[model samples]
Target: MKGNRHPKADIEAALKRAERAGLKVTRDQNGHRWGFVICCSCNREKLVWSTPASAGMEARRIDEFTRKHSNCA
Candidate 1:
């Protein structure tokens, strides 16, 4: 249960990556600086987080997530 302590730029970058991967992104409602990247065709999602220490990793995570779930209908 983390709060929105991460920078807004990081969150926006992650969301943009998710969008580029063809996933729908939505923010967490409980104050976490993270979002769920969902595959509409399969109705599946992956939780992507943004943190100062992991600023550069978000894109990689999104890439991996998209690849892993790419087979979805």
Candidate 2:
């Protein structure tokens, strides 16, 4: 049920995981961190990208939802 990926953490972890997995990290033309283009081992692994807005909104929404549904979240 994990949604709205954590962006900054995603990049860091993606790089670490890629290196650990021996995958190559690549960047897009805009100097944006595109992370690992492909995972060399499984050939099916890919990055799950998410934005900070979505992540923050998701977290806040979940927090509010939980708070509304429970005594504490």
Q: Could you say which candidate leads in lDDT?
A: 1
Query: After superposition on all CA atoms, how large is the RMSD of candidate 1?
Result: 4.4
The worst-scoring run of ten residues by lDDT in candidate 2 lies at 64-73
Q: For model 1, where is the 10-residue window of minimal lDDT?
A: 1-10
Clashing pairs in model 1, backbone N/Cα/C closer than 3 A: none
**Model 2: pairs clashing at backbone N, Cα or C within 3 Å:** none
TM-score: which candidate is best? 1
Off by over 4 Å in 2: 1-7, 29-35, 41-73
Error of 2 at 46 (Å): 2.9
lDDT for each candidate structure: 0.66, 0.39
* Candidate 2 local lDDT, 7-69, one digit each (tens): 455344444444454454444322332323344444533333334345445334333333333
Compute the lDDT of residue 43 as modeled in candidate 2.
52
